[model samples]
Target chain A: MTVTKGDVERLIDASIGAAPAPTMDQVKEFVTKTLDYNFAMTLTEPFYIKPNAEILHAAGKKLCTVISYPLGSYTHEAKLAQLKQALADGADECDIAMDVSAFKSGQYDKVKEDLKPCVELMGDKVCKLLYFASLLTEDEQKRAIEMAIDLGFPMLKTNPGFGFSTTVDQVKLAHDFAGDKIGIMVSGGVRTKDDAIAFVEAGVSRIATSAAFQIMADFDK
Target chain B: MNKKELAKYIDQTDLTPGEPYDKITEFCKDAAENGFASVCILPTLVKTAAAALKGTDTKVCTVVSFPLGMDYPEIKEIETKEAIENGAEEIDMVMNVGALKGGDYDIVNDELARVSKACHDKGVLLKLIIETTLLTDEQIVKACELAEANGVDIVKTSTGFKKMLPRSTSVEDVQLIRAHIKPETGLKAAGGIRTTEDALKMIEAGATRIGASSGKDIVDGLAE
Candidate 1:
């Protein structure tokens, strides 16, 4: 296989994922090494926005979080409360799960109805609809993508690391169906450079993974 | 007479709990007397609101999940039934943004299908709120697509939560949906839409209905 420097570079970029908010020393080292990347950090218990803002600004990267995380089964009040906290913390965007159980049962209307309130609750914030399409078939994915587009999601993402890896065929499936209607984000198991560049080439607008640093590190080396 | 033309819009909130007895009845009466288009009430008080405003131009609207749009299909179906039974004229339901984000497309489809069926089965209209502020521009478009695909009667903006109301229903949100959905579908803009300028903006942006805690203010502002 002809592995050129560019291939390795893309691999490094895609590999950039999770990092323990290192001491100022480690952070300075990483920034000195790599520049082009999307870095992420989840809100640890008891989120404090100001400190995170300072930390992220120093790292020169955007911040994101999940609300009513894992499952979107929380009461409206509870989910809103979580979102309020995320926004107050200066999160660049949020990954909110659309209560999946209701959607699976073919209760389109009930699911349909909630779009507005959820969006309202997300007011003036970046809300990315986490499209965990792993459990769904291609056609089913299309329908889901259609509904998500109809509801007005800012970003349509796949996999939150809860299931199967984010694959090429799947990304292609979403990209094909989504067309220009929405932006596609691929998360879950994106730990190497080969995949990240391929995903970008495949029309993925963003890549969410914990390997952001390695992707960056591999570049410097 | 055209309902939309006969009178101006009114929100007639439904979050109020328990026996609306004196509360909703009196409120509906005042609205009807003032020539408002509708009295929106909780599904529980649809009958009461409708009854109180009997013989007037005012209509009745109810919400499926008042503040949040996350619930099982079975429960939402029942809520739809109850709201229709109680004489609701329109139904505003929240979409499962979490499910969509989670990539559970089937779940999102099934959930909305159930509620939309309930509303359509009873001839009551359905308004799907994407809650624009919560969604990214792309996600917003996808949400609109889903609402249109499921046969929802309208695609609305915001449920009174979101960072900043998108300068009145966001012509972009409206135009995006307008580009796809059949002409039968409509658009609604809620949240921070109080001033006449706000109302006009939504109208221009393609919102057919405007949901506001400031409905009275919007109407009065329009008069001004």
Candidate 2:
């Protein structure tokens, strides 16, 4: 398995486009640079999606926006609305935060009910169920992964990466449980090229990081 | 302010996503026992917090379009209504700060009016979090104007989760916002409010409420 820098780039999902408090000029500059780098996907919030969709499309990069991000506590209706709005705003893919609070509270039905419509709405679009595997107990993580699998999400992401770190073990857990039924994407704890390559080897479909460019640079060596 | 009075101004918040259930239950119990104004939590835990604080004076408050108010007004409205049904007595929603910063006042106003109406219809109070740390003095004033104009129950300073540096809500910010908004519009100072001293400064600066995760620490500091 010879993983080249180009291979790594193709699997990278860079979030630099969504950097905080960027002026429109700064956003354009950053997004242009990210698109030029040819990362498989560039993630931004819904507000920035419409403005940059043309450039993203021109550069042949996928636009990934978040729905109920970081906190999956939004009601089912709100999440669906967010999903619809994100797509309407020119999102090619979405990383939706799952209702970890409900699942952890032992409200499995509530969790499933909340996500069903969003998944259905996403249809063929890439819908990654973003859950905080690092914050949950091992059993809870397993249950969460299983629930995502049961719900038929196209992809599953581990943690949202603001002080929450994900491990290869978590990715492995999802990879094993999902068993080709769904793709696994890991966001947190990926700081360097080695970490990114390792996660991909461990069975991740994508590696999301603010360190995408640095990882790409490191991969050049 | 005395400990009792100060406690009433605090909305004990744990809006951290995926916070453990045991932690939330304990948080609810502590907030109830301490008699804080409300236990502010994520939407999923609204029902749990409501159940925990059922017999107590503390209410269950939840956030909508939180930390980032990027959703459409219709979406935030539905979220507010659902949160009320789940037992959230107060709703601290983040206005579309991006729109405000981008000078799209119409989107911001529409969101505020719709969410405010949704909450008021259910006798729930709406606290509009404008994320003051991300805005300029003018933007803050404009945000207050919009919040006040839409009949928002309260104008909150920040979500405390700004992606950039200096995430705290300064006393000056509260004062500036308070000066701009009407006296009838309640003011809440959230984000980076920790110690009892910080709470008192915000209160003196005309803040009617304090949104803090360290509600126990602030009250206990006063007791000590």
| Top candidate (DockQ) | 2
TM-score of each: 0.48, 0.92
Of candidate 2 chain B, the 10-residue stretch with the lowest lDDT total is B159-168
Off by over 4 Å in 1: A1-221, B1-6, B9-20, B161-172
Instruction: Report the poorest 10 consecutive residues by lDDT, candidate 1 chain B.
Output: B161-170
Regions of model 2 farther than 4 Å from truth: A21-29, A176-179, B20-23, B162-165
Encode model 2's per-residue lDDT on B41-64: one tens digit a residue: 998788778888888999999898
Model 1: per-residue Cα lDDT over A1-221, one tens digit each: 44443543432212212322122233334443444444433332113333554566676655566654443443344455556665666766677766454455455566557555666666766667765677566776787788888877877777655334788888899888778888777877777667677787777777766566565455567
Give per-residue CA lDDT, model 1, range B61-89, as digits (tens).
Answer: 77765444544455556666776776778
* Per-residue lDDT value at A184 in model 1: 78
TM-score attained by model 2 = 0.92
Residue A44, model 1: lDDT of 25
Q: What is the C-alpha lDDT of each candidate?
A: 0.62, 0.83
| Tens-digit lDDT string for candidate 2 (A1-221) | 87888878888888862355444445566678796686878887766787777788877777898888877777777778778888887899899888887777777898888888888888788888888888788888888878888888878889887678898888888887778988888887688988988898899988898888788889667
